[model samples]
Target: MVLLRGFLVLVMFFLLGEALRVLADLPVSGGVLGMVMVTFTLMLRGRVSDELAEASRGLISVLVLLIAPGVVGVFFIVEQFYGQWTTVIVALIAGTLLSVLTTLWLMKKVSESAAGDGRHE
Candidate 1:
């Protein structure tokens, strides 16, 4: 039941995000919006429940498999990218690197701020 509730929370956010996207005609994907909603909720709560953490851990374990279909779909359209291979590859690499760096920086900033709140550095 805990897992079920956790899953429902995720689905609820996703649906809410989709509704907002349709209503606002936003450029971002519903999934991204859902994540933003999740982030906001987590921030407001200030703590993650064990059930949600467990469910999120389970999702992380299968994240690669979740992305496999999209990666495979890219293969089907490989030819379209072939003509702009250089640009495509460069963009992919740059985007991935930027994402990694941004995530790392944010993590460091968050952790440091968290640590600073009542502990000597």
Candidate 2:
């Protein structure tokens, strides 16, 4: 029930963002906007509910599955990169490394902040 509640909250925000995107004819991703709203909402609330935390953890565990579609899409356009495989692979590696490093840094900062608040486990 807790997980369901958390997912519901996330979905509500996503739908609201998608609606706003369509209505505003925005070029940005609705999911990104929705998450920005979530960040603000959580900041205003001053704490994350355990349910949300659990839901996010679960999603992170299954994140690779979520990324599968993008990988498959690239396959469909494989010919487009006929001679640029090295460049593509290098870009992918660089991007992945950068993302991982950024996430690690962010998590470290968040951990420090949470520890200061006695919220770290």
Q: Count the backbone clashes (under 3 Å) in each candidate.
A: 0, 0
Per-residue error at 5 for model 2, in Å?
0.6
Error of model 2, residue 79, in angstroms: 2.1
lDDT of 1 by residue, 34-103 (tens): 9999999999999989888887788889999999998999878878767798898899999999999999
**True lDDT of residue 105, candidate 1:** 100
Model 2 residue 13 lDDT? Answer: 88
lDDT tens digits, residue span 1-121, model 2: 9999989988898998898899999998889889998999999999999998898889889999999998999878878879899898999999999999999999999998988889544
Instruction: Report lDDT (CA) for all predictions.
Output: 0.89, 0.91
Cα lDDT, model 1, residue 32: 92
Worst lDDT run of 10 residues, candidate 1, spans: 74-83
Clashes of 1: 0
